[model samples]
Target: MTALLLIDIQSGLQETVYYGTERSNPQAEENCHKILEVFRNKDLPVFHVMHNSTNPASPLYPGKKGNAFHPLVQPIDEEPIFQKTVNSAFIGTNLEIAMISRNITHLVIVGLTIEHCISTSVRMAANLGFHVTLISDATAAFDKIGYDGIRYSAEVIHQTELANLKDEFAQIQDTVTFLTELDN
Candidate 1:
């Protein structure tokens, strides 16, 4: 069975000041919502992963509202949620066990920043033997400042992560193509 794994689509990610001033893929959340809608309508399994940052100043701190799921992809009552503090959803969470128990071998992934939780989870999922399809348009990335003082644009970080994961970790697809394939 296939499942949608949405990682950290939380309100905290919207605060660019916390992550970066420039964020790539302004339509990422909208694309994520589109995929979520289709997944729900089709009665497919959907798993939500929330991040509770240990950093007190972080927007995703446990007591902060930013830790809440974004309104766009809020989970319904029956949908299971796995909250974690780490980058990979598989660690410190039963997400892998749950999917394994459900016989879910294929994963359709979408979520917040591509270079962080998204990349980590994708690689880990592949390493664990699940077939993964990461939706390119349904994920975003923040601009990063290199240790050498070079600044990388958000688009570069996003595309690089996708390129790194493509074929090796996951089959990367855009929202429209993924949705079309899902319908077919």
Candidate 2:
């Protein structure tokens, strides 16, 4: 069965400066919330991945308020939440085992900073033989400085990651497209 994996939709990501100077897809959280609602309503399996930074000063540190999941996509009691300290949600967490135990063959991924945790998790999920569809619009990206000191915009990074992952790692779909799939 298909499952929804909301990866790292944490409050710390809202503090854009903490990640990068600029970020793309500001509506990603809301889109994630929309997808979450649909999964809950349909009684589909839903899993939440939370990033808990080991760095004490980081906003996602365990003791910080910013470590919490964003209000928009907060998990209900029944939804299992997997906490991770690394880029791929499967690493250092029981996420893969949980999905496997439940016989979840497909994963729909959405969440913050597409270039980081989202990308890594998508790639890992695909490698582990899960049918993966990444909600492109529901995952954002931050600007990065190239080796030559050129600054790339968040949109460029976002698009590049999506393109790199397309076909090779996972199928890419926008929030609207995923919602349409649910309807039919």
Candidate 3:
């Protein structure tokens, strides 16, 4: 069966000031909500992955308001929530075991910062033999600075990361196309 995996779509990641970076895709959360609606309507399995940063000064620190899940993609009762301090959700969590227990073979992944936790989780999911579909429009990325002091725009970083993951780790699709496919 297919399952929806939402990674690190927490309030902390929504603030660009916390990361000292600008983010692209202002409508990413909206798109994620749409995708989430489809998953719920279809009665598919849904899993939420939260990042709890170990850094004391980080916005994602435990007990902080920023550590809470975004309202748009908040989990309802019975939906499994996995917490991790690392980028890959499966590393310190029981995500893989949960998927196995439910016989979930396909994963539709969405959430924050395309080049970070999203990228890591997608790669690991594919390597573990699950079919992954990454919704491009349902994810966003923050601008990054290179070691040589070059700054890359969030749009460029987002697109580049998607390109890297395309066809290799996951099948990249936009929210519209994925919803359309689900409709039919």
Candidate 4:
């Protein structure tokens, strides 16, 4: 089965933690919606991965409004959501078991923090031998400090991830191609 992994589209993370310059995706919400629409139209499984922040005050922390699923990325009644603390979605989660049970192979991933959760999960998925397709435009990130001690722009981090990730763990594709392929 082909599944869409909507990784960490939580309100707290976007609105509270990574606000301002970080939420600067050209069409942030819409990009996610487009990906969601493709999965919905294709009648494919959409798995939502949410990060459970340990702090109650943290956006990703439990009991916080920001820790909840963002309104724009709301799931249908039948969809499944996995709450996790680790950057890798498969860790301590039933995600792998669920996918295995369903015989799911191809995974379409989209969501926040391309430099973190998305990157980690994609690599993990690839290492586990899952065919992964990362939505370049659908995933967003924030300006972050790199190992080089330099502040990197969101686009810079995103592009770097894309460039380095290709053929390493998963194949990176543009959102337009993902959507276009859905039309066929």
Candidate 5:
């Protein structure tokens, strides 16, 4: 079975990490919505991986209002949701068990903060021998200041992250291309 693992597509992350409310890439939310729609239409299992932080003020902290999934990528009634505190979803969560139970072999990855959580999950998925296809257009990150004290735009950071993962940890593809083939 093919499963779509949406990592950290939370409201707080979207607003903070991906600049969801900003004037940049206005189509980002639309792209995410299209991804969700296509995945749902295929009857694929949609797994929502949320990062839960211990800090109450952190966006991902459990029970915090911002801990909720992003509205654009909200789960359907039958979809499964998993909360993880660690960077890798398989580490502190039942993701592997659930995948094994479902006989899932191919994982379609999407969502926020490409440099950290998303990157870790993709690498781990590849290490665990799962065929991972990352929808490049569907995943995004925010501008980050470098250790060298250089500031990078969200797209620049996202491109570097994608470059590191593509053809190594995952096969990066456009969301529309993936959905088109699957829809056919």
Candidate 6:
């Protein structure tokens, strides 16, 4: 069966001040909701990966409201929620064992900050033999600074990271393509 893997789509990412910069794809959460609706309507398997940052001062600290899942994509009781401190959902979590146990072979991935958890999870999913379809429009990225003090725009960071993951780690699809496939 195919599963929807939502990585770190938490309230903290909505706080621009917390990230120290604006994020690309302001509509990302909306797109994620749309895809999530499709998955629910089809009764597909869904997994929510929550990032509980180990940094005490980070917005995503376990007790903070920022660590909570965004309301729009919140999981229903039947959906499983996995918590992890690392970038990959599989690391430090039972996600891989759960997927293997359930015989889930294909994954539809979406979430915040493409350069971080999203990138790591996609690569690991592919390496673990799951067919991954990453919804580009449903994922966003924050601006980044290089070691030399050069700044990269959120769009550049988002696109470059997607480029890096394409073909090797995942098959990139936009929200529209993903929805269309679901409909058919």
Lowest-lDDT window of 10 residues in candidate 3? 12-21
Model 4: per-residue Cα lDDT over 40-129, one tens digit each: 877888888889977665677788787888788898889998989889899989999999888999898888778789999999999888
Cα lDDT listed for each candidate: 0.95, 0.93, 0.93, 0.82, 0.81, 0.93
Candidate 1 local lDDT, 1-184, one digit each (tens):
9999999999989899999879999999999999999999999999999999999999999989999999999999989999999999999999999999999999999998799999999999999999999999999999999999999999999999999999999999999999898899
lDDT top scorer: 1
- Candidate 5 residue pairs in clash (backbone atoms < 3 Å): none
TM-score of 2: 0.98
Q: List pairs with backbone clashes in candidate 1.
A: none
- Tens digit of lDDT per residue, candidate 6, span 87-164? 999999999999999999999999987999999999999999999999999999999889999999899999999999
Clashing pairs in 2: none
Model 1 misplacement above 4 A? none
In angstroms, give how far residue 18 of model 5 lies from its true place.
11
* lDDT of each residue in 1-184, candidate 5, tens digit only: 8998888877777456434322223455567778878778777788888889777668778887778988888887788888888788888888999998999999988877687788999999999989999888877777777799877877878888899998988998887788877778
The reply for model 3, stretches above 4 Å from the true place, is none
**Candidate 3, residue 1: lDDT:** 97
Give the winner by lDDT: 1 or 5: 1
Model 5 stretches with alpha carbons more than 4 Å out: 17-26
Worst 10-residue lDDT window for candidate 2 reads 11-20
**lDDT (Cα) of model 5:** 0.81
Residue pairs in collision within model 4:
12-66, 53-60
For residue 77, model 6's alpha carbon misses the true position, in angstroms, by 0.3
Q: What is the lDDT of candidate 3?
A: 0.93
lDDT of 1: 0.95
Error of 1 at 145 (Å): 0.7
- Clash number for every model? 0, 0, 0, 2, 0, 0
For model 5, where is the 10-residue window of minimal lDDT? 17-26
